[model samples]
Target: MDIELITNILFAMVRSGTPLLLVALGEVVCEKSGVLNLGQEGMMLMGAVTGFIVALTTGSLALGVLAAMLAGVLMSALFGMIALGLRANQVATGLALTIFGAGLSAFIGADFVGKPLVGFAPIAIPVLSDIPVIGPALFQQDILVYLSLVLLVLVWLFFRVTRAGLIVKAIGENPWSAVTLGLPVLRVRWLAVAFGGALAGMGGAYLSLAYTPLWAEGMTAGRGWIALSLVVFASWRIGRILLGAWLFGLASILHLVFQGMGVDMSSNLLATLPYLATIVVLVILSSKQSRIRLMAPMSLGKPFHPAG
Candidate 1:
């Protein structure tokens, strides 16, 4: 369509994609350390509620964001204890985490329903934001938008250039050998889980504090699961995670745009596009299981013990 229309669409994609990008990136890190956290939804919900409450109470968005990250870390640490420390079933513990987060967020956020909170406003870069079509859509965004990109870069660099990054990679590839090398496999996994939790918390906070500026129960609305699938869909690569999140985000926003255009269709059906796309991608990837096996972390989802 027109340049204006195209710009609006691009801007919508960026806005819609940021939270997914954040969550998926965090998950990549978590999975890299051989921990499959199915509790992304729960962690995100906890973050959203905790972040909103802190922001509303203190009138400081930054403090609220910090609180949200802390909440995620605590939730994830619980997962680490059950899955990593106690040597429980990783998949089962993750599923339980999601259920716990949903009920807990509902109970804690029940009182704050319908209350409006100030959200992050866009910060336009002076000269760059004023440029023709690209600037505003790409450059003028809230702090978290930029932070998400920075996090992606950091994650890539962590795996690429740093010694700790190599150690984490080594642990993910073969925990037994990592242990043989005396790399502190359990401790590394715990740190990775905590880091992933923080990023997931940040993602959830971005939703409440920037995207919606309001608190709602189960507001994440399957984005967490979508983020989970995105990690696999990307084949555990950081760049692909970026592309996949935006693709899903664009699909998500299109349903809204369709409704705005007064297209006659079931809204519920339209809303299913993103989830449908996720399933399709998973099926495609699964059909090529050999490729996935090569890309995936060797010990993913398996609990590790030093002696075993």
Candidate 2:
């Protein structure tokens, strides 16, 4: 491919990856605190529909974003109440939340179907964007894209160089010990879940408000599940999450690239690439169970009972 074609592909890759990066980053933090939330897809749909409605009605993207985050937090709170508070099965609760979010979003968004709004536009950094190939792809992006990159660094630092990060890690590894040591294990996990919800919501918002700029039921198109897989694919490492998200993003957009190149492949089959990659990654990782055990949070998905 020519330089221009390569640059455009890179740009599209980053754009495609932004939502995945956001959701996966949050999942890392949530899982780090020993909570396994499978409800990210639900949270994201709630965010997307809520954001689109708020922005369309109020004509303010800022409010829309905040609303989307709030919607996600609310959905997560519901998940937490059942899974964390009531000590229900985490996996079941998460699946239920996804179903609920999907149904509710569809019901609420029925009126807004096919509606259009002005979505987020890219802003170019003057000097940096003027660079040859990489600049535009990296520097000229929508606000959410920049925020995702910044959050990636902040999250890495949060786990690497902060006391709170250590506390989260400690809780994830051994919540019983954390409680014995007088640490607030329950509270920490709750906060982690909430944070995850917020980011998931924001990821959804990016889809409706920036990525596609329209309200459509099921618009996330399994990106939420992909984000969940990405957390595993990255081995819960913050830096690896970015790499994985972008790689998946490239896979997601390959159909468009192939079509541009005049390749006569089945569009339907090409669309399956991202999901197929998810399954393949899980299979590979599952085969190396020992390695995954070493990398994953020790108490993940296990309910805690303080009275024990």
Tens-digit lDDT track of model 1 for 62-123? 99999999999999999999999999999999999999998999899999989998799999
lDDT of each: 0.89, 0.92
Against the hidden reference, what TM-scores do the models get?
Answer: 0.93, 0.94
| TM-score (C-alpha) between model 1 and the true structure | 0.93
lDDT of 2 by residue, 108-197 (tens): 999999999999999999899988888988999999999999999999999999999999999998999999999999999999999999
Clashing pairs in 1: none
Number of clashing residue pairs, candidate 1: 0
- Clash list (residue pairs), candidate 2: none
Total clashing pairs in model 2: 0
- For model 2, state the Cα shift of residue 252 in Å: 1.5
- The parts of candidate 2 lying over 4 Å away from their true place are 263-289, 292-294
